[model samples]
Target: MPVSLWAMEPMMPLADMPAMVLTPARVSQPQSEAPASVTVIDRNLIEASGARELYEVLKLVPGMTAIKVDGNVPTVAYHGTQARDSRRMLVLLDGRSQYQPGLSRVNWNDMPVDIRDVERIEVTRGPAAAAYGANAFTAVVNIITRDPRDISKHTVSVRGGNNGILDGRAAAVGHGDNTAWRASVSRRADDGYDEPFEGETRPDRKRIETLNTEWVWESDSHNTFALQVGGSQSRLERQQESGVADIGRYTREPVQKGERAFLGLEWQHVFSATHQLKISTYGQYNKEVTDFGVCYLDPFTGQQGPGGALLFSQELRELYSQNGGDTAATFAAVPTSGPVLSRYGSLQGVAGVNFCADSELDLQEERYDLEVQDTWQINDRMRLVSGANVRHDRVSSQAYLSGTEDNVSYRLFGNLAVDVLSPLTLNLGGYWERDQINGEHFSPRGGVSWRVAPGHTLRYVYSRAVRTPDIYEDQAITNIQALDMSEPFASNPEALLGWSPSYFFITQSSPGTLKPEKIRSEEIGYYGQFRFLELDVRYFQEELTDLLSHALNPFEFEPNNEGWVKHQGTEAQLTFRPTVNHLLRLTGAHIHTHTNKKTETRIAARDSGSALWAWQLASQWGVSTAYYFANDYNDYRYERADLQIRFRHRAGPAELEWRAVIQHALNKEPIVFEENQYQEDRMWLELEMKI
Candidate 1:
């Protein structure tokens, strides 16, 4: 059936589409409009799906990918670009860049606000480095909270389900003619699925509790001010140890926890009709801790053992010695100025007789940002858009077992846009960004969007982005080696000392000398609407240089010079709405990537490819089922995987959801050299409500 383009349309006029997230100042309008690439995920879409996390919500979006390696720690990829080391997305809460300078990655667990309070998510899926600066390689996520006025209702929600999952949320807003305030809190816990592909997968568990509070004062349309304070604490217990040698080996005790907090203030002013300015400042703090069991050595047998086990064994041995048996000292550390110490010495005080660890990773960050954006209507047929952003940032970290490091950064960025013709917009943006840790860089961006028809648009974009090195990659000094030195020196005690001091490489020494990773990305896409159908398609490719790779061979690994990696992908989405209340969407994607070098000695290739399909349905009554198929990287690196499913049903304001994810669904055995490269299967169920 052929139908008019206006047969199916949103209730609101397109020009008045909510600009709370992708604000009017940033969006590219038709002729005589600002020029930029922006995508807005509305609050309605959020409530309809009842998504619990950002990862699930981003799956349906174009030019983006949210990865759940463990279902708890999420990572995002934008454009056709995959992360080489750190996240390439610059995520902002309101107007403050929520970047952790110490790690060069956002602590997903520490994102202060719950999805419930999000009014809209404005995603610029390209090198916004010119405007956003650091970590804006693949894209930027601008999370805007709801206005306090519209959220006058108080609501509370609670849910529980499989894997010991439990969730609770509460929110309320108070609004006056000139003053408004909002407060919200949300908590979720789950005994997550076991580590897939690893043998004897044990249940990993995580809990996140978040709180956000804000106050806004507005005077007419020219002046507005807001102050926001947000905090979140998430504790994760995975089977892997923080400083352990091999993550795949050994069943470590559950002992990992992470916590974060943030506070921010913002002010906006309009000076006349064509100029506006916004200033924002924010501070954030994060702390993480991990505990591994104690370690010790036996005296008589000269064998390694747990601290508790060794203590018990030593007591028995002492008893035997008192009864005229042989006495032996397991670990005799001769103090320089005192008698020889007979007890074991903890590794840098992280290990002890009890093996209870207090080691922690801590980061504190502060930022001040100022932006001036203006829309100048030069004439009836042409408009000009220009803006400048200045940012100052400080990041500090204290590692419980290691030491401390601090870094400071500053950036100045600007962009210009011109509407060439009616319904056509062209943009050119660029920025000069500098960081204390990575020196300085210049990133440039160009984009064009054309309204080919009444309800159709064609767009092309090219941009350059950057990713900074993290403390973990730049300064983390590991003592663990792939070939256990102890095994080779079991017979001869002095053999271990023969290893050179450079055996365990230290990649970083100077702080401000590391270079930033660079990415060049190009994209073209089309969006069209006809009758009950809407189709969107995009194809993108990203070229990367000076990428960071975790090298299994320490001797060959270096920072910044690991060569290049490439990521390319195709995305397509189709939506069909037979009626106002009945809507269905189908999304498909194909991603292919390759690194300059392989991470393993046995594998000669560092390439991976995957194809995925997702289908969704919606109605007011709320019963929807989705199917997903994923084929793993088809190389010697890892084995392939298969289909997954999710089902959801809503009763009242409460929603019940279920997920069944299978890893290596088709493969039975390990094709790679990795141990226990086998299939992983699990099912999860969840229930949520709103009051």
Candidate 2:
């Protein structure tokens, strides 16, 4: 994988703050009524936790691990799977998809909305393919922004802290009796780690700027219209930390930069008190330019063969294809060790000085989606929701795909819930989707919920889901077109014959070869609501097959789907809010993974938990303390504690709010990896005003 594919921070520790969610079954219903386990973080929880990024707040959810892959790019994975190329989950921003199909990843920093603008976040901690089709294999993260009518007239927020952290946001709202609109702009920057664990002065830094706006109009009781427009630009310093290619490498300025924009419109019509229809469409565009100069020595974390040969060269692959998998003839054509080294020089033959590859992971992706959904309350005991959507995705990447490719996907999904008996309810849903590349698939989900008592319920759910391979995974041609050599090779380029060519190509583009990742999940859950406390607990077992992975050695790297893995876990979340002045929240999960290879556990966590306690000391003062624990990624334990204080004051008609937070790592020395080690402590202070 290119360095740009390098895909959270100390968890801004979850308060069970929301009682209703709209993600589980695509309807606004009490959390207890949803078919899946749901966790919600409200704006109040966001304020008390002092979380500046979306992924930071996600640590509150059970069975979810949010971390920075290289202490720069934000990655949030449920039941942690391969994180560097985090896939299998679906992310939505106000009903619009935030995932890039081109890379099959989420650029959380480049998202237009700021943390302050988010009203609430709901996570469905299970497969949602029955409702969202493919790519909802593990979970769904739904971010709901503050409604235009609910935004304050004017708001400003600013924060600065250690590690070169600086952030600022400004928002304005304009509204009348019939219409409301909101506009906001924000900027954030951070200078990562003083120094890396292994290497000193690592080039790791990030900056992002965003502009967002929304407009809503109520055209009478039966009709409503909404429009949204947003854009963001981001810059990140990329550092390739490991392998011979990266060792002793000097720092470079900004290595990657990206810009993205989106436009959306929606119309809702209410035919009756119990029936409604919604039609929505959105268009999104994103472009990224990346630059890196590195030698092709060793790419994978684990070295292979004798000196980690660069055998997966495009020339050898082409020769192999041309010779019909005749390895003898193929190698004969592109000899590994000859006078000229044939097409690709042997790893033992090429020294560091004779190799230079102008590597770029540049790409542009565009997506358009249109959806129509209808909901009907057939009776007091029956509810039905159904929807259909079509998505068109276009990706252009000369380095990744070698050309432009477009695919159209169509999906039809529906969910029905009926009270079969006085205390039992049944939920049945399915999704049928057809994609140009992934073909057609139908996933079904069935669940039953029994209301044990007035405030308690039990649920059993079963679902089947799939994750289609991304464009880069299916049709990848990773290479550098321009090859620049130094010294000896520059003086006598022809002496090497046609070994290096004009450039060194990594993989020959292969389309329609890899299969989709598939999963089957079974869960038993319980929810209880009382006057003083609430509880949500779940036990789940997931079996995944045809997983996508490849060896790091370019010569041996071939995307294949034959792996099998199973994960079983229990997740629980509890909230104790006896009074409005005090609150206590706890969340935890324990998982055991059985993979084809035991050494592959680095992508999954064995145990994770968090606790938070808050007190309203006075009318204008409040304090909160949070702690997080997670371990078992190569047996590395991560522990962190957070303490925060909030203050508010009145200035004429405006209100001034202040927040200060301190986070410290509790682990003396936990080894996540050899190259990237997190700082021991981080701190920040924030000021916000509303007029």
Candidate 3:
């Protein structure tokens, strides 16, 4: 019988381990000798932590901030919170890009792969454009799944808990001739938080179903081929606002439906012991539909007029005439001066002229990518990796964009690592990229690692990365339903009357093609592994320019790249094993940022830390506990503890396992910034069987 790598006992000696990392330079390298700060979360820790969500797992990593906007939507940030969508970080699942081009956000709930299938997740704490091209601005997360060879049989798992949570998963692995395959299916549903704001409805309920499969074939020892396909469908309840005049209120319940699918293929050839080549291709499709319903009150009647249609009273007509110098003719025309007026008029007509209560936004996007890479071992002391990729993205939307838009991008990157001496290694890498929307740009990175002693290493790294504007940011034609006239306006004759425009249309017209946001970073790091402890520390300073932010005007909210920021931070992680049965880990981070925009850092905490302990109580039983703390960020401050326990036993021909997890065991209500939501403690139980 072969021992599973994931079945290894916890608290292994650091001196006996050689961790391999791939995100730093797009090539496998020793974690101790990597040029940047990298963190690896393996399956053992993942199972022991008993975290159901990917974002929850990230909370344990140093310098990573994971927070739930509600129960279903989570935002993960690496350093500073510049935006809500988390566009600065690049995420990949099994080498396939997970970044959505339309919203520039990773929809964690829509990810096709199940958590149980993930073997490891590698995180790079800083810029990695030299390896991942544009949009790898602040960090990169690479999720690697278990290979088919590692799975010996079929497995099934089920989970149920509070908040109407119900989850189930099934997976199978098999081999035929020279081909190996693995397939998995998962379904999850939750009612989300039960608490509601004063005037807001209960939001964030979500349901997701996914299927994933992969096949690998070895034609010979030197050549290999793999194919992967996956898809997901998700439904989420959203919170929205609706009303007339000054007495607007939130809708009871709004819903969003999303669907995504992807297919990928790869071929690898090993020419010799020192040379290799790989080719990969992938395609992805995504679509989402959201219904935003607003209700208008008749000024004269002082009652709700209709549910889905926007009713423009006489007061609104006069207001539009007073603002734009034209009334019936201009009001009949769409507000923005763009080619999309025809479509807008056809759909909703002029806001004041035509009343459409049920307004819906439809967004669809498709992307195809092809890449080829070569790796050459020039000598025992030197190696080089070069790659080129071409990608095409197309977006079609009615709410945010005027019309269908397509963008094509190309990237070329190379990295070189040379051991100048037995104690010193030098690394250099760069990427050149061209995109239809942002034109062309170049990013470069260089670093040196010095092994000062037998178990200690020091490194210095400098890198440049870029974040390109997303489709929505570059071309948004948003129409917002503001307010309608009420009894107060009707009673006040002096106020503008007879015109009740329930909606305001805002459009952004770029002066020219926008430039990509740029960042230059410098970092120093140290790593040491002693008898019973391992430590890693890094300090970094970054200069960010051409940041994309919103510029508000009376007419519209425009996207402008006019701000700069400076960020400095330190991250450290320590691991201590007092005995083979007990392991302890501590992680902390502190960041200081100066930005031209005040709101850029409003939700970011200045410091955060976590302490985790895992103990193997018996040969078949284990328990873990963790405490997390984050300093005050405006009105938001949090300190929470979590606990988990696992029990395993072998049946006649299968393995049975039972696990329990309790999140926020302290049951404290922490204030959240900029959002009117409540947090609650939750617990879950899971049972698994393997045959």
Candidate 4:
């Protein structure tokens, strides 16, 4: 329960010592012994950054990119591959995967745990599927929260910022002889984007409330049991609007709201000093309530000749399905954006439709996961860590998935680290999975760590991994129907049914016929530790095949494994804390990508980096500054500088603190999307009390 017992404990570099990590190999070892490169962001650095969201803190990692896809949805990616849907990156919150199995995306800001509770973050900057399972393709991010005993008995904090930002948080801790518990709650709300893009209103606002609780019991000296319960409710504003058109533009303002809950249990038994076993089980439930308006054509009453209503969006939806989702003939069968409209005033574009009616996107996703791990210190020269997990996932969605889709998957993984030669360690690991949809898959890794000097190490690694398609990617039938948003339909239509055809049936599906995306990676890395400096650098080359990308059809939403990309790059991160009064951190990445597809390179930032400097003026006064420099990728750049100052004072039995932060965007260029860029400077003020 102490701060020193972090998952990847490096002791915060207080003295001259190499940081030990557990994520790289599932066993605790110093950075000099690990086979891969890793970046550790501790609690001190996280607080010094003055970031309110987890995604904002992720920018300090090398080769890491964080952006918003839909203006409201926060997405973080490593190597900038597919920033819209970072399917290749595996994210974990206290060992539980954060990758959504149904939506095939990660909701960075919708996590149940508040950022204030996080103790540290460990980032493995390459393929780590051997220790983890399938989704650990490009990188692995592990967020570890603080234990109850590490914090005060009670604490409360609130912050208000420019551009409609507000947050309120409270936490309490209690303990008996052998048990310690903590409970925390937070309410976060923000008005997304400072202004509207070109024409569309910036409707990317969000409101969320979360509750997280943890109980750790030392049943005995040999057995420990830990339980965690968490839940969150969020309302994320979503809207889709089109440009100017002769048929009158179409817009769908849908409020995507959802509830997420999870219960996790872990039992750790220490048989002896050298041997230990841990069993973990968790169950999660996610329910999303959302609906959007649709405008469809009455197929029975509308024209149905060879070149009639059949060429509209609804008819083409069925035609594309009946003939397999590979061809674009159906989309071609319709007309492009022009004056001549299709029959029955069908959708003028892919997502456009004339009229509208009510529709609901309601779905429930459930997951049951269980895993057992064993760590054995066989002797002085060898160590073994092995684990296996079984998972069952199911989803029910009438609006998107027609009905229900469920599957059960299993994985077996293990790693062995041995001192093959003095000053050299050989690590070998593998993971094998029997997936319900992706079938049988295997990931393997081999690495060698050579300690050349007292505090210097050189490492070489080769790894192969795969990413299975998600539930929606594997099987989903998404379509909606409405009369029209305008004009004489039925004054007010009834709920959606089988009576009419669909509108804007831009479905994204690939059932029973999709291969998992695979990656072959090789890297040369180095890690060094000194009295006041810690450095990690890596040069990697990756070849990816069978990547999930859009099908040939530009109008429809279908994903297939037809993309190939090769990347050669280098990334480095360094931390320098010469004394207790000053701290400095720097990170940079140079990316060179070779790919024929434009979609693959949409977010590949050629040269990107970040820097942070903090100063402790007095015992109660502190100030920090941060700079984020980005590339001109996608014809847009985000360069920003931030200054944060804080003052702490003693008041009665509680400690009072006041903090302020100001951020100035230097480039003033559009961000991920044209509608998301903010040119003005942002400011925030916070007040906190601890007892």
Predicted structure 3: lDDT: 0.75
Ten contiguous residues with the weakest lDDT in model 3: 306-315
Report the C-alpha lDDT of model 4 over 402-470, residue by residue, as the tens digit. 789998999899999999888899999999999788889889999999989878889999999998888
lDDT of each: 0.54, 0.78, 0.75, 0.78
Q: Residue-wise lDDT of candidate 3 within 1-691, one digit each (tens)? A: 3222224655457766676799889889887788789988888767656778777788778877777655567778787564355678899998888888987888888888888889899998899998899888899999998899777789999999887789999999999888999999998888776666666556778999999999999999999999999999999987553222222233324588999999999999999999999999999999998765444443223444321122333333334544553334444553553422332233232223212244456789999999999999999999999999999999997556756888999999999999999999999999999988888889999999999998789999999999988877776654443333233433432322222334333233444456788999999999888878889899999998988755432243456788787889899988777677677888999988888876567456788888888887876788888888777444467677889888888889898888898887353443454443556677789989999
Question: Which scores higher on TM-score, 3 or 4?
Answer: 4
Is candidate 2 or 4 superior in lDDT? 2
Prediction RMSDs, each to the true structure: 9.7, 6.9, 6.3, 5.2
* Residue ranges of candidate 1 with Cα displaced over 4 Å: 1-39, 79-86, 194-203, 242-254, 296-302, 305-358, 361-392, 398-404, 471-512, 551-557, 599-620, 633-691
Pull out the clashing pairs in model 4: 355-484, 355-485, 356-484, 356-485
lDDT, residue 506, candidate 2? 36
Give the lowest summed-lDDT range of ten residues in model 4.
1-10
Clashes of 3: 16
Worst 10 residues of 2 by lDDT: 1-10
Q: Candidate 1, after superposition: displacement of residue 524 in Å?
A: 2.7
- Candidate order by TM-score, decreasing, is 4, 2, 3, 1
Candidate 4, residue 131: how far the Cα is off, in Å: 0.6
TM-score (C-alpha, index-matched) for candidate 4: 0.89
